[model samples]
Target: MYGFTIVENLQKIDQDIKRQELKYHQKRVMVSKEFSFDAAHHLHCYEGKCKNLHGHTYKVIFGISGFVDDIGLVIDFGEIKKIWKEQIEIHLDHRYLNDTLPNMNTTAENMVVWIYEKMEESLESDQKDCRVEFVKLYETPTSFAEARREWMTHE
Candidate 1:
């Protein structure tokens, strides 16, 4: 009876270890970061109020998805923040978005897409563990625009 109990306990321990190993091996996680900038813009074609230069405290949200690597991280938050600051935030902060992206009118929708593209391009070049999943651009606290790739759309 004593021997049988010992065998049963060992089997249970082995199963628990296997379960933990499987959990560690199966990797799916999503991480996100947010940034903000204040920028001015004007629409060239607008005949109304927006034709004049205007500014907004823009807030940006970025979502990244992928398996956490062996180090148990999707990607370093600092790295993402750095990329954002360098690629998007610093350039647009307190400056005219229209002057930077002159080819496209700096509407909220177009800015969102442009941000998404910037994030995608930066992440593709910098981070290998995760991909830029979504981008949201807030023109104001109440108004915002979002853009996602066709592959990333949820149904």
Candidate 2:
């Protein structure tokens, strides 16, 4: 009877250790930052003509994904937003997108990639663990563009 009880307690301790390990690896988290800017652009060429200058109140959404750290947070959302505001919105807002971005053609697709690149640079400079997973740029109420880093090849 004494030996059986000792074995049962050892098994329980093993199970508890397994549970803790599972909990540690099972942590997945995502954090996002949102920013907006108003920018004007004209497509250089079009059949029906979006050639005329126009502007949109553009909305940009950035997503960062990773396993939560021991602190149980992927990253501080406020810090991400501040980076976006400084690096993107402050520069692009009330400006011509084509003129503001060097070598960028200012289409929604190009703008999305540009935003992604800027966020990537800023995140790296800040020494942040989270990466710029994806960028979504809303050009209009019904139209948008999305770009992902080459590393985000899964989606």
TM-score of each: 0.78, 0.74
Ten-residue region with minimum lDDT total, candidate 2 = 5-14
Show the lowest summed lDDT stretch of 10 residues, model 1.
4-13
Candidate 1: C-alpha RMSD after superposition = 8.8
lDDT per residue (tens digit) for residues 31-70 in model 1: 8899988888898788998899888898999988878665
The global Cα lDDT (0 to 1) of model 2 is 0.76
Best by TM-score: 1
* C-alpha-based local distance difference test score of model 1: 0.80
lDDT of 2 by residue, 83-120 (tens): 87788787798998777787756789887887788888
Give the Cα error of residue 113 in candidate 1, in Å: 1.0
Note the residue pairs that clash in candidate 2. Answer: none
* Leading candidate by lDDT: 1
